[model samples]
Every structure is written in C-alpha cells, then in structure tokens.
Target: MKLLRVGPAGHERPALLDADGVARDIGGLLGGAEGAGGARDIDGSLLADPDALARIAAADPAGLPALDAGLRIGPPLARIGKIVCIGLNYHDHAIETGAQPPAEPVVFMKAPDTVVGPYDTVLVPRGSTKTDWEVELAVVIGRELRYAASRQEAMAAVAGYAVAHDVSEREFQTERGGQWDKGKNCETFNPLGPWLVTADEVPDPQALSLKLWVNGRLRQDGTTGDQIFPVAEVVRYLSHFMTLYPGDVINTGTPAGVALGQPEPRPYLRAGDVVELTIDGLGRQRQELKPA
Candidate 1:
C-alpha cells in the first residue's frame, strides 16, 4: 500500500493508492466521516490494521476523481512533531567526508518548518554557500514508544517509509559556531513524499538502492545496504533516550556521493539546478533549486 496526502497545502486530504493502481479517498476513513471524534484520528495502529487495509485494497477507485498529477503532495503525516536525523550513518559517506566511522550514531534535528512536498523547489538561502543534497530513507514512526524492548521490536514500531532530500548548508553546519541544526533548518530544506510505502510492502529496508541527481547529473549514488546502523537498530538506539510518537519522523541518513564529500568541495546551489532522488520501492522525488 502506498499512502499519500494530496491537494494544496493546508487543504491536503488523506488518500491511499491500492495495489491495482487505483486511488481511494481515505480522508473520511481517517476520521470526520461522522464528524469530529471518529476513530481517534487514524494513527499508526489504525494504519497497521489488517481489516482496514483490506477495505482500502477492496475499495472501488472508479469515479473517485483521478487525482490531479499537478497537485501538491505534502508530507504523509499532517502534523510532524519532530524531524530527527542521523549523521555519518553510511560507511561510504563517512569515508567520502574523510571521517572515520563513529562508535555510535550521531543524531541531529531539523526544524519541522523545513518539511515540504517531494516536488517542491529547494530554496538557496540568500548569501549562502555550501548548500548540498542528501538522499535519504525517512522512517515514519507509527507508535509512541520509549525504551523499546529490543531491536526486533523496534522494527515493528515503524509505520512506513518515504524518500527525503536532507538538504543542507555546509558552512552553517560545520563552520558556524553551533550544532548542525543551524545549517539544516532552512525553509524548504526537507522535500519529502511521492508516497509513503507501508513497512509491510518493503521486505527489507536495508537492501534497497538509493540515489540523487542535481539537474541531470548524478550526485549521490549508493544504497541503504551501506548504512552502518540499519533501520531497526536506529529505532532501538534512539528509543533508549527519547520517545518516538506517531507522525514523528526519523531521517536514517544518506549514502555516499554528496557534494560536500567532493575533493574540490563545491559550495551552495544556484537557481535552476533540479534535484532528483529515489529509494527503491519507496518512490522518487524531483525538486528544483530556486533563489530565495
């Protein structure tokens, strides 16, 4: 099942793309059918239900108003509370940046305002240098959990997955006096979507191929197989300290080949440079870089 939220910003509605290639309106099923207070507002548990899924699968897509291809697709989750990230989680990415693999995952946060639809333009903040792109596999938490029992149990906590471009500004991230947050939270930095593929549909998250391209030139080309800390372990590791609630997002880091990792060290994006990225089975995204 590929779940998506479509329509203009703020007016977006819940929708599901069934296996047979039909789009079903799940907005009512997600509450509001009987008005407010219906079914507790469709969280991770509701999404994981076999019966609910079957209903969506069996839905008649006919006359459902073929979704406008040009409509904006927002983040699958309407109200994302936190945007957590992992740094240097890919072995090749570590080596590319001339750094050794860390003993444990390096965590960071990007402001929720950075979130945008998959095809939205990525803005290059004025007077900025070192803007870069990171193609990542984003994990969407399906349940609220603190101190998960084990790594295996942690995998069960995932609602689904999506393709995310962890856009960054290297100067602000490394040169400025502060944490990586300063460089990562720029408006329109995180372009997510295309569709959120359910966890069950992804047989093995670690085995997927992921890549990114600037304009038509390939920039980041690697795979989740290169991740030093796989998805399950990442969830379990983070849960030991902070709680992960439904709709919370975890960007599981990117593979090698980022512009920052280049030998000559390119800095910043120019207007008209388009970024195209994808993760196997998860779907793809294309974002044009625009001037602020």
Candidate 2:
C-alpha cells in the first residue's frame, strides 16, 4: 500500500494509491464517516489503530474519490513529532566522510518543522553556501516502543517507510557548530513522501536500494545492504534509551557522494538547483532549491 496525502497545506486529505494505480481519498474513513477521535492528522495516533488500517485496506478503493493529479501532494504523514536521524549508517558513507564505521548507531534529531512535502522548494538557509543533500530511507514508527526487548520487537513496531531527503548545511553542521542539529533543523530541510510504503510490503528493509541526484548529476547510488547498522538493529538499539512513538520518523542515514565527501572545489546547492531522490519500493522525491 502506498499511502499519501493530497491538497493544500493544512488542508491536505488522507489518501492511498492502491495496487491498481488508483488514488483513493480515505479522509472519510479517517475523520468523516467510518470513525473519529485521533490526532486529526496522519500521525502515530492514527496508525496506532490496526483496525483502522485494516478497514481502509478492505474498502472498495474504486468507490472512493480519485484525487486529481493537478492537486498538490503534501507530506504523507502529518503532525510528525520528531525526525530522528542515524549518522554514517552506511559503511561507504562513513568512509567517504573520513569516519570509521561506528560500533553503534550515531543519532541526532532534526526539528519537526523541517518537514515538508517531498516536491516543495528547499530553502538554503541565510548566509549559507554549503547546503547539502542526503537521501535516506525513513522508517515510520507504528507502535509505542518502550525499551523494545529485541530486534524482532523493534521490527514489529515499524508501521511504514518513506523516502526522506536529509537536507543539511555544512557550515552550520561542522563550522562554528554546537551540534549537527543546527544544520539539520533549518526550515524545509526535510522533504519526505511521495508515498509511505507500509512495512508489511517491505519484508526486508535492508534489501532496498537508494539513489540521489543534484541537477542532472548522480551523486549517490547505494543500497541498505551496505548499512553498518541495519534498520531493525538501529530501532532496537535506540529503544533502550527512548520511547518510540507513532508518527516519529527515523532517517537511517545516507550513502556516499555528498558534497562534504568531495575534494576541494566541491559543489553545494544553490538557488534553482534541483535534487531528485528515490528509494526502492518507497517512491521518488524532487526538491528545487531556494534561498532563504
């Protein structure tokens, strides 16, 4: 199932693109006829109800209203509480960034405000010249995980997955920086969606491939197969110290080929540059750069 949202910002409606290539508006099932009482958005609270998703899947998609392709498609999930990130999870990425593969996952957080529709224009922060792009596989938490007992438990807690662009500014991240979050949390920094591929459809998260391009140049092309800490382990490991809630996203890090990994004279994003990314089974995303 490829879940999505369509319409204008703040007025987006829940929708799904069924296997038949039809877009069905499921907003009625979410807030109108079939049910009520949740976050009023596509957050963890909505996904927490297994029954709701089941009902949605069983409904006749053809009966549901078809979304006009001309309408804007917003982020798949709404009200994201946090954007947790794993750094250097890809072995090649670690080596390219001049770092060794860590024995454990390195975590960081990107402010939720950074979230936006995957096709939105990304703002290059003021006075920034090193804006960079990272295409990652984002895991959407489906259930509450309080110190998950094992990797199996963690995998069970995953609701779905999506393509996420972990946009960053190198100057804020590494120079005069207190933490990487400074560069990570800038508005419009995280472009997520196109569709949230339910976890059930992705039996092995580590088997997917991901790619990213700047303008027309392919900068990153790698697979989760090379991840130093695969999704299940990363989720299980993080659960020991924090509560994982529904709607929270875990960006599993990028592959090699970011501007930061290049030699001198490396190029970074500038206004008008377009970034395109895709993760197998997750869908595609494209963002146009804009100056803040």
Candidate 3:
C-alpha cells in the first residue's frame, strides 16, 4: 500500500495513492465521520496498526473525492516522532568520506521539525556554504521495541519505507565543535515521501537503487545493497539502546558520491538549484534550494 498525506502543509489530510495512481482521502478510515473517533492528525497510532494498511489497500478510490487539482503534497505521515540517522552505514560512503567502515552503526539525530514535504523548498543555512545532499532509504517503525532479538525480529518492526533526502550543511557539521546534529537539524533538511510504500510491498530494501541529482546534474547514484550495516541490523542494534516507536524514522544511510566526499572545490547547493532523487519502489522527491 502507498499511504500519503495531501493538501497544504500544516492542514494536510490522510490519503492513499490508489493503484490507478489517484489520491483518495482516508479521513473516514481515521474516524472523520460524525460521532467517529477524534479527528486526530494522521499520527502514530495508524502506523502501529497491522490492519490499518490492509484497509487502506482495500479502500475504493472511486468512492472517495480526489484531491483538489493543485494541492501541495505533504509528508506522507503526520506526527513523526524522531528522525534518526545512521552515518557511514554504506561501505562506499564510509570510504568516500575518508573513513573506515565501523564494525557497528554510527547514529545521529535530526530534529523532527526539520522534516518537510518532498517537493518543498529547502533552505540553505544562513551565512554558510557547504550544504549537501544525500539520497537515503528511510525506514518507518510500526511496533514498539526495546531490544529486537535478531535481524528478522527487527525487520518485523518496520512499517514501511520512503525516499528521503538527508540534506546537510557540512561547515556547521565538521567545522563546529559539536555533534553532526548541528548540520542535520536545519529547517527543511530532510525532504521525505511521495508515499510510504508498505513493508510488505518492499520485499528487499537492500536491493533498491537510490540516486540524487543537483540542478539536473547527477551527483549520487548507488544502491542499498552496498550498505555496510543494512537496515535490519541497524534497527536491531539501536533497539538495544533506545525504544523504537511507531512514527519514528530511521534514515538507513546514504551510498557514496556526496558533495563532502568530492575533491576540493566541489560546489554545494545554491539558491534556485533543484535537487531530485528517487528510490526504486518508494517513489521520487524533489526540492528547490532557497536562501534561509
């Protein structure tokens, strides 16, 4: 099932992209009828429900009202709790950034507010150059987990996957005397989702090809197959240290060819640059860079 949210930014509504590629409202499924449950945002509870996606898949698109012709697409889900990241999880990425692949996953955090619609304008940090792009596969959690016992168990906790642009500001990251979060948490840094392709539909996350381009010129092109840690292991590993909850997102990491890994004098995003990316089954997301 491909689940999404549509409409203006903060006023978005739950929707499903039917097989015919039409957006169908899911408000009724979320209890939008009179006397129905609270008209809550498409939040965490929906992600945790096993039957929710099945129902969405079965929803009749013909009976629902199609979205207004030009409404903006919003992030696929609402109330995403955390934007977790794994650094250097891809073997080629680690090598390109001049580091050895760690025996374990290296983790970081991006403030949830940093997330924006896939086609939204991305803001270049004030007084800074070195804004960069990373094409990654984002794993969304469906179940509560304290410590997943194995890779298979960890995979079971996954709800779906989406295409993600893990935008970054390198100067704030490596230059500042702080964690990588500094560069990662800037507004509009993480542009996610055209749809959250359900886990059941994505059979093998590691087999997908993800690529990104800046201003129509290709920059990053690699596959999850090169990931050093892989999705299931990373989730399982992180579960030992923290509780993984519904609506939480884990950016499984990027493959090589980021601006930071380019030789000296590599150009970064400038105002008016369009960055577009795609992951095989997950769909594509584009962003136009703008001055902060």
Candidate 4:
C-alpha cells in the first residue's frame, strides 16, 4: 500500500493511493469518518497499531471518497519524533568527499521541524552560495527497538521506506566550524515523501537505486548497493546507542555525485533550481528552490 497524506500543510487528511492511482480518504478508518471531530493523523501510534494497518489494507478504494487532484501531498508520516542521519555511509560518496570509509556509521541529526512536503519549495539560506543536494533512502521505524542483537531484529523494526532530500549548505556544514547539523537543520531542508511504501513491498532496501537532478540535469546517480554500512547493520548499530521508536526516521546517506564532489565552480544549487529525486519502490519528490 502506498500510504500518504493529502490536502494543505497542517490540514492534511490521511489517504492511500489505490490500484488505479486515486487518492482515497482513509481518515475515517483512522479516527472517525472523514470530517469527524476525532480524526487522527498518521503518526507513531498508528504505525504501531497492527489492527489499524490491517483495517486500512482491507479497505475498499471504491467506497472511499476520492481527494481532489489538486490537493497538496504532505510528508507521509506526521509527528516524526527524530531524524537520524548517516554520513559518508556510501563508499562512492565517501570517496567523492575525499574521506575514508569509517568502520562504523557516522551519525548526525535533523530536527523534526526541518521536514516539509516533498513538492514544497526549499529555501536557499540568505548569504549562502554552497547549497547542495543529496538523494537518500529514508527508513521509518514502526517499533521500539533497543540494543538490537541482529540484522533481522533491526529489519523487523522498520515500518516503511521513503525518498529523502538531504539538502545541505557546504560552507556551513564543514567550513563554519561546527557539526554538519549546522547546515543540515535549516528550515525546509528535508523534503520527504509522496508516499511511504510499506516494508513488505520494498523487500530489499540495499538494492534500491537513488537518483537526483538539479533543474533538468542529472546530478546524483547512485545505489544503496554502494553503502558502506547497509540498512540492517546501521539500524542494529544505532539501536545500541539510542532507542529507536515508532515514527523515528533514519536517512541512510546518499550516493556519489553531489555538487560538493564536482570540480571548481561546482554546480551548487541556487534560487529557482529545481531538485527531483526518487528511490525504487518508494515514491519521488520535486521541489523548486527559493530565497529564504
């Protein structure tokens, strides 16, 4: 099931894309019927509820109201607790950045407030000239996991997968004398989801291809296959350090070919640049850059 949320930002209603590609209202099944006072958002609690998921999966698309085609799509999951990121986790990305592959994952974070709808406008911070793009595979957790003992245990905790745009400002990330989060947590930096494909549909996270384009030109073309620390191990490794709870997201790094890896006059993003990215089996995202 390709689950999503549609309508305007903050006023989105939970929906699911059906077989014929229609967005069907499932908000009723979640809390109460469509406009009921007790409507619920798709969040950590819903991800942890098997019965709710079962009900949604079993719903008939024909019986549900279809959303208007013009309604905006929001990040599939609401109330995202935290975003854990792996840096230089891809062999090619590490090589491009001229860094050695670490024996363990390099983790950082983006506060939840940085998230925006996939198709929303991305802000190019004022006084910035090194805005860069990274296409990544985002893993959404559905279960609480602590000190996972094996890959299987970690895999079991995943609820779904989504494409994430890990936008960055190179100067702030490296030369600004601070952690990567300095550049990473800028407003609207993380654009996520047109859909959240359930884990069962993905089957293999490492096999998905990730691609990104600036304007109409291709910039990043890499795969999870090149990841230095694969999904299962990364999850398992992180569980030992922090509790992985439902709605927590893990951005499993990006593949090579970012503007940062290019030669002099590296084609960094500017105002009006459009970025589009996708992951196989997951959905795609497109955003236009604008001045903050």
Question: TM-score of predicted model 3?
Answer: 0.96
lDDT of 3 by residue, 70-170 (tens): 78888997888898899988888899899988987889999889989998999998987899999999999988988889999999999999998999999
The lDDT values for all models are: 0.81, 0.88, 0.87, 0.91
Q: List the residue pairs that clash in candidate 4.
A: none
Top lDDT: which candidate number? 4
True-structure RMSD, every candidate: 2.7, 1.9, 2.1, 2.0
Two-way lDDT contest, 2 vs 4, winner:
4
lDDT of 2 by residue, 132-155 (tens): 999999999989998888899999
Best by TM-score: 4
lDDT of model 2, residue 227: 93
Worst 10-residue lDDT window, candidate 4: 31-40
What number of clashing residue pairs does each candidate have, in the order they appear?
2, 1, 0, 0
Query: Which ranges of candidate 2 are over 4 A from the true structure?
Result: 31-39
Candidate 4: residue 105 lDDT (0-100): 93
Q: What is the lDDT of residue 104 in candidate 4?
A: 84
The number of residue pairs in model 2 that clash at the backbone is 1
**TM values, all candidates:** 0.91, 0.96, 0.96, 0.97
Two-way lDDT contest, 1 vs 3, winner: 3
